[model samples]
Target: MDEQRPAHILVVDDDREIRELVGDYLERNGFRVSHAGDGRQMNAVLATRAPVDLIVLDLMLPGEDGLSIFRRLRAESRSPVPVLMLTARSDDVDRIIGLELGADDYLAKPFVPRELVARIRAVLRRVRMLPPSALAESAVRTIRFGDWRLDLLQRNLIDRGGVVTPLGGAEYGLLRLFLDHPQHIFSRDQLLAQLARREFEIEDRSIDLRVSRLRRRLGDHARDPRYIRTVRNEGYVFAQPVSYEA
Candidate 1:
C-alpha cells in the first residue's frame, strides 16, 4: 500500500495578515500551505509549487478579483482544483456567483479558524473519495434520465440535441447522489451529510441553492419539476427513472 500524503493548500489573498494566519493554521493542522497575494502571484505559485489539492481564495483582492481569477483558473487548468471562497460581505450575491461559477465552498470573513479548517477538510475529502472507476473511465459511461444524459466520464450533462452543459463539482456530486437513489426522499440534513457539507452550511441555504441550480440545468421548474420534485417540508426526490449506458 502507498502512503497517503497531506493535502496541499493554496491561500490567495491580498491581506498579508490573513494569508499568513491561514497558512500557519493550515500547516499546523497537517496540511501544506502556500501563500499568494494577487492573481499574478497566485499564478506564479501554481506554476512553480507542487500540485495544490485545494485553494482558499478571497473574493476581495487588489487586482483581478477572485471571481475573474477563478474563471481564468478554470479555463487554463486541465484538472479542476477545489476552491473555498472567502468573502467579507454579508450579502449572498458574491457567494452565489462563486457557487454558480463552480466554487467548492465559501466562508464569510470573521470566520473561526477551526471552521475554515473543517470546511477545507470536507471539500478535500469529497474530492479524494472519488471511486477509482470514476477517477479513470468507468465501465458505465453515461446515465439517462428523462431527456437529458449525464456523462459520468466527463461530469457534464447532454441534452436531447447533444448540447453539453458542464456541471460544477458540487452540482455533479448532488446530482450523482440523487441519481444513485431514485425515488428516495432526502431531507436537507440528509442531503448535507451525503454531500459532505457541515451543519453550519444549512443556515446559508446551500442545499437549496445547489438544487435550484441543478434544476435549472435540467430545465426542471421548481413549481412543476418533472425530474426532481419537492416533498413539502420533508425534502426533495428524484422522481425520474434513470437508465445506465455503457
Candidate 2:
C-alpha cells in the first residue's frame, strides 16, 4: 500500500524472536518496520516520526495482550490503525472476538512467513486500493443509484432517510456489483465469482450471509424491501435503476 511512502508497520509481541522476525520480514518487503515487546512499547512506537499504517499484534503478551490493546486503541486514539491479530489458538471465539472488536485480519501462530507477508500486503492494499481513475471521480463528485446516494470516491452511502451507514468489506462489494448491473439476475455462483476477484472468500453461504448483512446495513426488511429483491427459485436481482452523477 503506499509503495512510495514505504508503509510504516509496528510489530507488537512479547516474544523477542517473534517481534524481530516479523519486523525484519516486513522491512525486507520494502516497508518501514518497528518492534515492541509489549503494549507500552507499542505506544512508544506509535509516537515515532513516521506514521504507522498497520500493526501486527500478538494476542497473548507479558501484561497487555492484543485484545486489551485493541480495546484501549478504540477508547483512546483519535485515529484507529488497522490491526492483524496473531494468535496461537485455533479457537473460533478468538477470531470472532478479534473481528468483532475491529481487527482487520488474523494469523494463527506457526504460519508461513510468506503468507504473513501476503496478508499484510492485502490488508494494507485495501486502504490504497482505489481505482486509478478514483481521483477523477472525486473531482467530478456525486453518484446516485435509485434511492441510494453513493459517494463513490468518499466511500459514503446515504439512504432514503439521509442516514449515513457504514458498510463492511463484503457488503460494499456485493452492493457495488448489484448497482453496477441493475436488472441483471446473477446466481449466487456468479456473485461469488465477482467477489472472489476482489477478496479472499469461502462458500456460497458466505455470499448469502453477506447479502443478509448488507440488507441489515441498508435497513432493508425482507418482508418489504426497496432496493434488492429476492427470487424464490431463481437468483437475486438488483430491481432498481442506478444513476450516477460523477
Candidate 3:
C-alpha cells in the first residue's frame, strides 16, 4: 500500500499575522499548509499547487472578499473542496451567507488556535471516513423523492428539469440521513451528533440554517414543505415517499 499523505490546507487571508500564525500552527499539527494574501494569490496557489483538501478562508479581505472567492470556487472548480470560513464575531449574517453558499464550517475571529485545529480535524475526518465499498454502493444507487433525484455516487442533487444543485458536505450528509429514514423525526442534538464526526461546538441555529438551505434547494417552501417538514414541537421529517434505484 502507498503511504497516505498529510492533508494539504490553504489559508487565504489578507492579514499577514493571521495567515502566518494559522499556517505555522496547522503545519505544527501535521497538516501541509500554504498561504495566500488575497483572492488572486489564492487562485494562483490553487491553480499551480497540488489539490488542496480544505481551505481556511477569512471573510474579510482587501479585494475580492471571501464570499466572492467562495462563490467562484464552487462555480468553477470541477470538484468540491470544503471551505471553513473565518468571520467577525458580530458578522452573523456573513456566517449564514457563507454556510448557504456551501461552506463546510466557520469560526469567529479571535478564535483559539486549538479550536481551529479541532474544527479542521472534524471537517477532514468527515471527508476521509468514506470507505471504498460504501462509495461503490452509493455510486450505483440514486434516491428519488417527489421531483428530486439524489445521485448517491456523484453526490449530486438533480431537479425535475435536470439542473444539478451543489451541496456542502454537511448538507449532503444531513439530506442522506433524512432520505434513509423518511418520516423519522430527528431531534436537534441527534442530527448534530450524526453529522458532527468530532467534538466541535455547533449552535442550534446552525442546524436550522442548514435545513433552510436544503429546503430551498429542494424547492420545498418553509411554510409548506412537500419534502422535509418541520414537525411541531418536534424535529423535522422527510414527508415525501422515497424510492431508490441501483
Q: Highest TM-score: which candidate?
A: 1
**Over the stretch 112-149, how does candidate 2's per-residue lDDT look in tens digits?**
88888887876675445433443243453555766678
Q: Per-residue lDDT tens digits of candidate 1, residues 89-149? A: 5745777677656677778898999999988876675565444443434566888889999
Model 1 pairs in collision: none
Q: What is the lDDT of candidate 1?
A: 0.80
**Local accuracy by lDDT, each model:** 0.80, 0.73, 0.79
lDDT order of candidates, best first?
A: 1, 3, 2
C-alpha RMSD for every candidate: 10.9, 11.5, 11.8
Query: Per-residue lDDT tens digits of candidate 3, residues 73-172?
Result: 9899756687899999888678767755657777889999999998888667645543433234535478888999998877899988899987767789
Worst 10 residues of 1 by lDDT: 195-204
Q: TM-score of every model?
A: 0.58, 0.56, 0.58
Model 1: what TM-score? 0.58
